[model samples]
Target chain A: MTWGIIGTWRMVHDGLVAASKMLQENKRVGDAIEECVKAVEDYPYYKSVGYGGLPNEEGILEMDAAFMDGDTFEIGGVAGIVDAKNPVSVARALSKQKFNSFRVGEGATKFARLAGFECGNMLTERARRTWELRLDEVKKNNLNPYDGHDTVGVIGLDLSGSMAVATSSSGLFMKKAGRVGDSPLSGSGFYVDSEIGGATATGLGEDLMKGCLSYEIVRLMGEGLSPQAAADKAVYGFHHKLRKRYGKAGAFSLICMNLKGEWGVATNVDFTFSVANESAAPAIYFAKMGQNDTTVIEPITEEWLAAYEKRIKQPIE
Target chain B: MTWGIIGTWRMVHDGLVAASKMLQENKRVGDAIEECVKAVEDYPYYKSVGYGGLPNEEGILEMDAAFMDGDTFEIGGVAGIVDAKNPVSVARALSKQKFNSFRVGEGATKFARLAGFECGNMLTERARRTWELRLDEVKKNNLNPYDGHDTVGVIGLDLSGSMAVATSSSGLFMKKAGRVGDSPLSGSGFYVDSEIGGATATGLGEDLMKGCLSYEIVRLMGEGLSPQAAADKAVYGFHHKLRKRYGKAGAFSLICMNLKGEWGVATNVDFTFSVANESAAPAIYFAKMGQNDTTVIEPITEEWLAAYEKRIKQPIE
Candidate 1:
């Protein structure tokens, strides 16, 4: 039996390690994704998601998340939801319904409450201080406030051959209130078909939504391209086309895993991800755009990991 | 110069005819979409869009709308926004921004107010009575509460050879508060590229979001397929596969117009649409699913138009 899991960013590594064990034991795809994403959401130091995620311009902490069951094509999502400790868990619960699966703002927060999911203030003291400092800097220096848009996107394939995908983010740091990124959007943010494969994205939500790259990659995989080839073709091709047509393209990253337990990744900027499968242990890798529409991927280095750990935990002042 | 415009449902017929005149005049794609969509929003007799539209289970007139610029690939959308007299215009304004193009709920409503676009309560007296009756019937008979989810989706190609797409809807009748549908989603409800073509959809947003059929149709057009072939292949193929995978496929209809002004349509259930182009005047057509995944289309009969006009304005008890 072959089981696999892949997620964007270094933050998801520990969660994937736990979910990886569940997959090996033949747990279903739905639970595997929720457990993995919830771990990222609950962590207090990941500044782009859940507990410690940065706030919008108004200093309010809103979040976006989505869950999709590749087997049944059931999709549920929430955007601009607040005070939900684990937005991914709320998304998973909503996926069971036939209608009203995607909710936003007050509705999404209320669902978390009415359904008896865990709820608490997500804003951390460090996060608020960081937002205040950034707000002051941006105004003083006339700096761009759009930053820290990473979303924890996970793709899981179980021993039963079922696959599922989920994504969660606090959206662009200092974004306008109620802004929704591609993290909660289908096709752009995530797409999976258990019979074919699954793909998820993290990056500039605005530009990512312009090209439904996740859906395109899965479609390419279904047409017989390997996951690597599909990621290369879909991601690089659209990145080039978008620059030509739209005059500029924003940074974005994508990862995919096919039904055979093979996986692939591509990006226009530096990206890190963790993955594990039947043949490999959970490991983190860093990738960057390479020459000729390719991606250069390597094992995460000790120096980079150590630096990241130090930076996230640095003093707020 | 060649020009074209197509929109979902007979409800858009009058609006399309008015916009057809502007398309021939070489107006920009942005204003053309807003003008057409706003007409539908203002017509109080229409019960599924803008003013006079059906409300959610809570009897709130929440609305969803989106606008996309094909040349630059800018997208703006709003979901669960309340009391906006013309959500399409607000979406158009948001598309010009580089960040925070999509907003939801209270934030969306606030954006409309802050931007100084028109605002008013959207629920009509007749719509409120209909909601009351439906609520009573569902409680007494235990019938399905989901119905009347048609969205006004428009695709416009102007004399300048530019294309754009827009959509507006009140979402599913009696949906849970803050429920969102495909109308505001990028690849599901609508997609456009001035270099290739544009497509928009109507019917069940829940089923529609699962397929990303709008992007598929446009991509097929990019591959040199005629609009008719693209629509037929993308819509019918997904419809067939979805039923096999998910056990049932909801009703859906799609309409497309290529850059050259050629157009096509496909659907899984009975549908109606209005189209105009360099070669054809604005006219409504009826379509139905035919044998072997083809769509059978015929000009709308005068009797059918008369019946529709009467049905929409009929009194609600």
Candidate 2:
């Protein structure tokens, strides 16, 4: 059997690595623990997810997150958490705490702080100032405040054949208050199944949520489709439905891993995500958006991924 | 007074040249009409507003178009017309005849055939036979029919202070029948006014219609915004909204001419559209999507305009 986990945000990744280490030592699943730990510590940029993300129009860093364990079908999520240093921790808490499945808004932020996270000061002073100035500019221009940039996610499969997926995002910068995108939404943002595969999404949360793209991707795999086909179908279906409603806007980037150790990736726009496989070094992939009609896929090198990882971990003094 | 016409299809350019000659001899508008007519006939592949465009999902070539005489807002349009040898004629008929607009569908095709244009049978023996072989290969791999592809369009203004715009597309190839895109929809697909400017859109039709992006661009021009600024705002608004709704699936390319005899162009993706002016020749500008986030602008060249004028006399075969 195999087990895995996925998440967005560096802090959350660290926490998951720590937790997985604890579980590995205690539960005696020894083979894949090193890779899982390494994946978390290897990749950095959480602008799309986690507390360090760029703030919205209000100069507040809000977060959305979810975690799922394929073996147990256990899921945990939190949305609209403000000043939470690591929103994924809340999702982890929910998954580990049993009774807590979800949380939202100020309460979730408070819980994270109480749980020993560094909260209430997630944004650096410079970011806050920039956010304030941009907010005013957006207001003057009559633009939406919440149109933030990206989302983050993590997924994994363990040695015992269990899988997990997690996601987080700051939502759109300058979005309306209390706006929840697909990040913390179950099924839409995160899905995991040890017998099939696991998938998570970032960008254009509402469209991903409305179409239930993540879950559908996993479900498609369960129906015996290849990982690539599942990813393509999921993205295509979401686009078709979205075209019927809002036209087009952001993008949806996804990573899925099947039971046999195969992986698939799909997206409508440029995206960045990382992965770690047994016996291989952790790596991140950056897909650049192209000008032509076709969507081309490319992988970022290990060197770039390592450099980015260092950048994310460097603390502001 | 100044008068000019803009067209997007390969043959429509020919028609515009014929019309320009007629108008100059009978009406006396000079360089503007000559340049406008020339711009249409020379551009080999204006995907959004021309013939032989990339087909929609059904592999059928459908067209959307509009023309505006800035002096009177005398406009004519036809959307989703398939099998017509020259959709521009139908659009001209709408302006010249009692009816003034038509939507894409079988009926539109019938009207074109009845009006003496050659209408090719859709998915007849040859097309079906080709599909049968291709479908079997795709089905063997369990792939869905609808995927992703590009669409096309055209817009222009003349020296006589009159403006006209037109557009066409084959819709998405292998698409479900009865799907109408923004091409045929007024305001969404194309808009023109000598007092303000003229604009036309291509890409995701649904988003263009929902946002009324073409009209928005023109209105921005009316508000005294530079054509570039107006186009940027309109495209940005539509892009943001669409991302919020469905992720990013569509884009728009536009050309605008202000009353001051200045021209503007904008787009959200990598695409191209050409313009001809009294002082210069018709020149084609290519915009590469995602390479530069900001829009690019340049003045038309005199030599290009001269060459453009030379190509406008004959009917498009």
Candidate 3:
């Protein structure tokens, strides 16, 4: 049986491995994709996704998430939702509805509660301390507090040839109340087609939404481009075009997988991602821009893993 | 001078004519696009946009709108906003921000207040009466209350070679609180590029976002297809694909204008729209799906106009 899973960011590596094992056990695409993302959401170490994720400017841990089923083209999303244990699950449930599938703010919370989904305060003491320190740092240094937002996006292709994609994020740290990134927005944050493939994005959502890079990558795959070629053409082409048109482009990274279990990635900034397929076991890789509008990727090293472990667990102060 | 304006709905005909006069006067693209949609938003008879729009299930009138600048790809949007006199104007203002450009729910309302934009109760007496009657009808006849959602989208090309697009809607009538449609979404609701032109969508936002038709139309235009061919290929093509994949497709209409003052439109249901250019006077036209996956367009008849006027103002039962 051939099945695969690919996800944005190095943080999802642990979850992808478990999900990949489930795929090996013949899990459904939607269940496997949700499992991959929900694990990351439950982990308290990742600061840009769920639970311990950073808060907005008003000290609120608002979240965004979306799920899409490739076979039915059913999509559901939530923006600026708070106190949800697993937003990916909420999005998956919403996808089954033809109307009111996408909700925002308190309305999203209401839907979660009315649907009998578990809820709790998502803020963490460590996260709160980090927010305080960051606020002080910005006040003292006069620096931009809007930086380092990484959305956990996972795409899964099951043995049944079904595909699904899900994304979750706490959004840009220190963002204004009710501010939403592309994580919950279709085409911008993610797009998947079981017959062709799927793609997802992370980085500066304000810039990512401007290009619709995720949909473009999938369309290219459907047109017979290899996953690598499609990712390169879509990401680099848009990165250059945005810079020329908008004067400068913000950082963004994208990953894609085709129906054949082949995968690819591209980014304007240094990025690390995880992937597992029939030909490869779940593993992390680092990527960066190369010469001639391409991406250079290499397997992650033990040194990097050790440092990341220390960095995430460092004292809040 | 080469300039033009195209807007969805016969309701925007008056606004399009006024904005067309401004475009002829060498008004900037952004200003003209805003003027076009704001008119419909302020009009009481246009119950699906801005003031006097239908309320949600909770009886609160929430609005969604978006603005995009073609030259810079700057986009700003608000979803589930309330009591805003001109949602398109607020969206246009948010487009100027580098961060937190998209706001939702009460946060969107708070941003409007902080920005000093005008505000008023969007729910009108007539709209309330209609909502109450619709609720009764749904309960009595077991009818789906979610019907007749039309977003007013406008695209403009100015003499200075700039282009912009804006969309505003009250979303699906009798929707749940905070339910957002494609009106506030990028790529789905609107996309513009001075080099390639722009496209905006109306009708069934939930289904529209699945195809990212606006981005696909602009992409097709970028690949050298004419505006009409692009619209036909994208709209008709996606309509069939969605039906095949999702088992059904919803009503949708799209309008596009290239950089050369050329325009096109396609729809899956009965639709009316208005357009004007340097070569023609502003006029409303009717469109519907034709044989062989094409759009049939013709000038609106005087009888249709009189009937529409009577239909909007008839006493509620």
Candidate 4:
């Protein structure tokens, strides 16, 4: 049986549902879902995804999130959310509160925090160290730090014929106080259909919003293109036309997991992200800079996976 | 006069020669040349153009500059400059230098200071204020401030039938420590031919270097489109295609002054830039949020211009 799911910010809620169901049945599916959730929970930048997100120029971390269940076409989304421990919960709340659609903001954070999760903090020390070094350079060069740039995205497909896609971001730091990137914009930042595959995007939000590159990639998958091919074509479409009009100032990175259980990722930047398959524990695949000779795939360990799962499933309290 | 100027960073050097000669012979032409130079010198962000450029990620404000003389196909450019008060001088130096180019890095600031100009201290109080505001926002949101994004560009063509393009920037805030943007990359960021008018670009340096959108706009001008139309098309091409593929991200604002002495500028961001014709003084322009309205063009007065020019031209000492 084939299924389909599609969305940008709503996909996280859908993933939670899928995970809940999987937990009631098989350990592997539950484990994978749990790992993903924890990945966002533990990663400092993950605040862009869940409850703790970076604020705009106004010093407010308003956030957006989405999740989708490929098999049911079920979706969840939340926009302009503040105080929500994770935008994912607002998505889930939407799924449960409204029959087919729902939206929430302002009170959502308090609601999620009340539901029992700890709020996230600033970027990790490791990430902070990395940023400080870069900041020093910026200071030396006298450049503005609020210039719009950066975001995060994720996509996954399970062997049981379920597809999921999720995106979360704090948006451009010091933006005009209320700017939103494509991270929460469906079709632009992400899309998934069990009949085809799954894809998630990152880059210049405005242009991405215009191109609908993520959904376009999934549509190409429906046309029978391999995951990689779909991603490549979608990216190509934007590069060829949009860059010309806008100037060479934006990028897109995507991951596609097809119905066949095969996965592919493509990006214009030096690095992107991916975790290992079930049995292939202890490895995570990262696209490194200047290593264009061949693909480099790393490993994730079972121990790490176990800890990650614990981190995710544990109550935020 | 339909000549195509090519090369990496030499176009600016060539442009200065044409501009200098034009300045000496025609009053209107001289005024325009002076305006172009003043634009760089006065704009606080234009450290890469005049003197007092902030260091690169490596604590070195090595600079590169170029000038394009549209009428003569003459170009001038200088690269790896340090402490040089005015890169335009190098463009002037190009006319006398045997190789038609010069590299000033170490002692470049010393050279400028020794030339009786103030050197060092590129960061202004205004820039520091902007940086602080951005840092506060970043800290509040927990974002990484050094994530690479900084460059500025200017292009103009006078009613007198002379066109000039210039770019100034501190390069990427924390790049590889020696990276350069499209600003100094001929045919990419800056391109001009009096027969077709002129163009200047800003955005992801490497991708812009590869795409050559500026020259493409000039080519479009050659194909008989208005300067504005040509610039729009070129920017559109990049926004749609190149941006997504290279994970590149930035906004490009370009202005073209045609042989008919008309000017055109286009951008994808809400607050891109400001423009002033010969009849008007330079001021900042910003687009209203969520609206596709014409940018809010502010006008500067002669008094302001005089003060600005005085401040910018005063010896750096």
Candidate 5:
């Protein structure tokens, strides 16, 4: 069976590589996606995800994560979890919990501890330095809020033909304590259907929640659009919707994959992603949507449809 | 313009009547939905929503609420909020807040306080009696854990043809503290789109979250299905998806309305709702779905589609 994995940002390149190894060892789709997201969280450069990531305004490290197994259609998630080094793992455990599908805050922390996970400080020195600097900036520049865009998510299609997705984030740097974004919540940040495929989103969780962006991408794909086409349309729709209300929109990026292994990434702002499959080694690729790009990447337009109609009438090239 | 409001349970009858009065007074769709949800939350009988509802296992009253404005395509919500008299009002304020779309836990409490909302204990004698009884039942029974359904939600259409939906719940009785259900989440418990319509859900939030039930119903309505048909299909889909794993499914109820003011309700378990429109006074309705029903509610199937097609093609008398 054709299988692959895709995620947003260059930080995930290492994660894709590690995930490829798990696949080589015949790991399950759900396990591999969790590991991939965990690997990215382990990386230090992308300070918006994993351990030692950015802290909330109260100087506490609150994190959110979600894990889904498409074959079973079972999902586990934890939000506002503190002192959990690998929140993704906690989410995985919660997915298997007999009586619950999601847990949050002290409840989440308690679940993590009861699930045999360590509950200790996750803040690192590096993150502390940045937190101090951000706190000072907040005091001086009237910048009580900030945003970061390094969420690590992974969607994998395994040899068993089962698909899975996982996402983890520390949310906006210095965000209000107990402020949850779209990450741990399904449909908005991530969605998977064994029949149609799956999608994961990154960027501003607030806008993504408004549109339920990832689920819309999968829904469009189910309606016969190609993965690339679906991502394009979903991104365009989000941008159009957000622009009308806010005058300008924040960044939004999406990665979509069908069970057949076909995949695509779309973004309102330029972003990078990593992919891995049997045909090639894990590698980084750029989806150029912002000003730096010379090419215009537009969603399916009437002109494109018209050109396709005309092509059918012409001789084979 | 045709304007209406629909909500879960007979308890919402008063709220619907109040909302209809607001619409008659030319209130905005967003405002009416918020006010209706608040009115329900203020009701003392519905022990699953708003202040003084069933407390969590920790004896804390954590409430969840979501508000979506279809005209603006904007949403705001609060989850695991404590000590706020009206979590629905907090959600409304968040929707108008310039910087954030969601808040949860202590952060949500602080935001409410800063926004001039009173924060104090909401526990009531009636709810406390139930909580104490349920806690004893939990201790004595060898029974598998049980789930309850008492969430209250409201969807409204305004004279301007805009749509809005809101949901509020204390979640499952004695649930883990900080455990969020579908209520405050956009897509799962409620979804609104001016172009299509809106949907709200009740019953098990975990299952609802897995299916993104409200959004799916709205999506089906967008795909040309009538509101009743869409709700039926959504409930059936949810059942089919859930039964495969658990061997049984939990209660799921839905209320849907199109932009034209046509509305419908469906539930796998017998449930009642209240509706109000410009054409009539507020009234209670029942949507009963169970084994005893002669006509089985089935998911989208070829036979069903064929029958639908035939019905449409029949000559009008």
Candidate 6:
């Protein structure tokens, strides 16, 4: 069997590297997924996910996260979690709780406190700066079209053919207090069935949730579609149906994997994701709408942006 | 064109009847759904859902609710909402919000306050008595096998072929404070699409979320499975996969409809849901496992339990 890890964007480069090393050392996919998510949760550079991340309109940090064990189909999640350092870990804890598979808000915060999770300010200076800059842009009718930037979804395939997925996010910047998106909801952000495959999504959570994007991809894969085709169809549907309601609220991007360890990605917008297997260094790849070819690899270096620009050739509107 | 409403159990009979009345009066499906959910949220006798219904282990009334407009595919939800008298209405408000589609916890509470909702004690005397009695039973290792009872899911289809679904819950009885279930999550407790129809679910939220139960049923219906057959397959799958990890925590139940106005219900366990159409009074129907035929209607009477007993002929255990 083969093993691999995939995540959204170069921002999670460290997380991808860690997950790759764990797989290289023959760790279980569950452990690898948790490790990757935990690493990303600690990385302050990314404003949309984990500790020290973006805050809501009230300047409060409320996060959402979910974890799924592919073999057992056991899933746990927490939404609008405040004062918790690692929502990903808190989600893992809730997953193992006997009577509850999900928690939210004050209840999530209280549970984390009882579970021995540290409570403190997760806001970093970097996030505050980004929030202020974005707020100014919002006032000028120039909203940031970076809804996809708010999530760090990690999927791992172990050598034993098992899979696991973890998704964590601080959610939309300056969102209404208590606002929740697709990050913590099952089937919307992440879904796994060991018999079929696994899927994780990044985009506007509202769009993803309405389309049930991740689960749709996994279901399509089960019905004999390739992971790439499944993802393409789901993203296409997400964009198609959403435009009929709200005009172009960003596009969904997805990374999908089947039981055979084959991985693919598709997106309605120009986007990049990181992939790593035992054979090589973790690398960045680009996927875009209407692309004929399925997957392409690029070095995880300075040339990455140049290569992505060449691949799409069109400016991001 | 016709209009109808369906909900879990007799406790929601009043709500279903109200929704039917509104539809008969030419109200939109969206408005009818909201009205039904609000009625359930106010009813007091039911221990599993709505205001003054039940409390978590910490004696908190953390509620979850969602509203979906089938034609538009727009969804709004709030989880772990506290001190809001009508979480269903709050969820409706979130559904109409400009940017965010969901909110939870303190944030949900704050939004509800801003939206002109009354914030007060939602607990009542009957609920306290139930909690005390249930707590005693729980201490004796007699857990309430009623996670399914946590939700009041309502689906409405108007004569115009439009559909809408609303789900609300006080959440699992004596659950961890802030615990959330299938009610507020799209594709779990409810999912609707104008072209394909809609589905609403009740049961273990975790199992439903992992299986994407409601969405699966709707998809099966889309693939030409009759509503009954589609619900059967989804319930069967929900039971099959969940049993591999947790033994018999109560199987999921689903109610499905197609654009043609045909409806069906299915479950792994014996279940009875309330239904109301354009004609006649709100009624009760039975659907049991291992039956040759699915969907049997019975008189809506005081002897619902005894009539259900006659239909199943098998003990719940």
List-wise, what DockQ does each model earn?
0.84, 0.01, 0.88, 0.02, 0.40, 0.67
Q: Which wins on TM-score, candidate 3 or candidate 4?
A: 3
Model 5 clash tally? 0
Candidate 3 ranges with C-alpha deviation above 4 Å: none
Tell me the tens digit of each residue's lDDT in model 4 across A1-317.
32222112222333444443443344333244434454453344333444334454435556656665555434455444555555654454443321212233323344456557456543434334434554566679977655433444555555576666666565654443323455654555666666667777766564454345666677678788887667676676556554554345355566666776556666565443543343332124444212332233344356755675575445332
Q: Give the per-residue lDDT digits (tens) of candidate 1, residues A1-317.
A: 58999999999999999999999999998898899998999899999999999998999999999999899898999999999999998888888888899999998999999999888888999999999999899999999889989999999999999999999999999999889999988999999999999999999999999999999999999999999899999999999989998888999999999998899999999999999999999999999999998899999999999999999999999
List model 3 lDDT by residue over A79-124, tens digit each: 9999999999999999998999999998999999999999999999
Chain B TM-score for the candidates in order: 0.99, 0.71, 0.99, 0.66, 0.88, 0.88
Candidate 5, B76-104: lDDT as tens digits: 89888888888988888788754556887
Across B37-149, the per-residue lDDT of candidate 4 in tens digits comes to 54454455433344334444345445655555554433444444554555654443342321212222322233345446444555555434444565567679976544333
- Candidate 4 chain A, poorest ten consecutive residues by summed lDDT: A2-11
Q: Is the docking of candidate 4 incorrect, acceptable, medium or high quality?
A: incorrect
* lDDT, residue A306, candidate 5: 64
Which lDDT tens digits does candidate 6 get at residues B90-162?
8877776546878888888888898899889889876776677777777898766344354788888887878
lDDT of every model, 2 decimals: 0.93, 0.54, 0.93, 0.49, 0.80, 0.78
Worst 10 residues of 6 chain B by lDDT: B308-317
Compute the interface RMSD for candidate 3. Answer: 0.6
For candidate 2, the lDDT comes to: 0.54
Clashing pairs in 3: none
Order the candidates by DockQ, highest first. Answer: 3, 1, 6, 5, 4, 2
- After superposing all C-alphas onto the true structure, candidate 4 shows an RMSD in angstroms of 16.5
Candidate 4 wrongly placed segments (more than 4 Å): A1-35, A42-53, A96-142, A147-152, A288-317, B1-317
* Best candidate (score: DockQ): 3
lDDT of 2 at B203: 65
Q: On residues B1-317, what C-alpha lDDT tens digit does candidate 3 reach at each position?
A: 48888999998899999999888888898998899899999899888998889999888999999999999999999999887899999899989988899999988999999999999888999999999988899999999889878999999999999999999999999999889999999999999999999999999988998989999999999999999999999999999999999999999999999999899999999999999999999999999999998899999999999999999888877
RMSD for each of the candidates? 0.9, 21.4, 0.8, 16.5, 10.9, 4.7
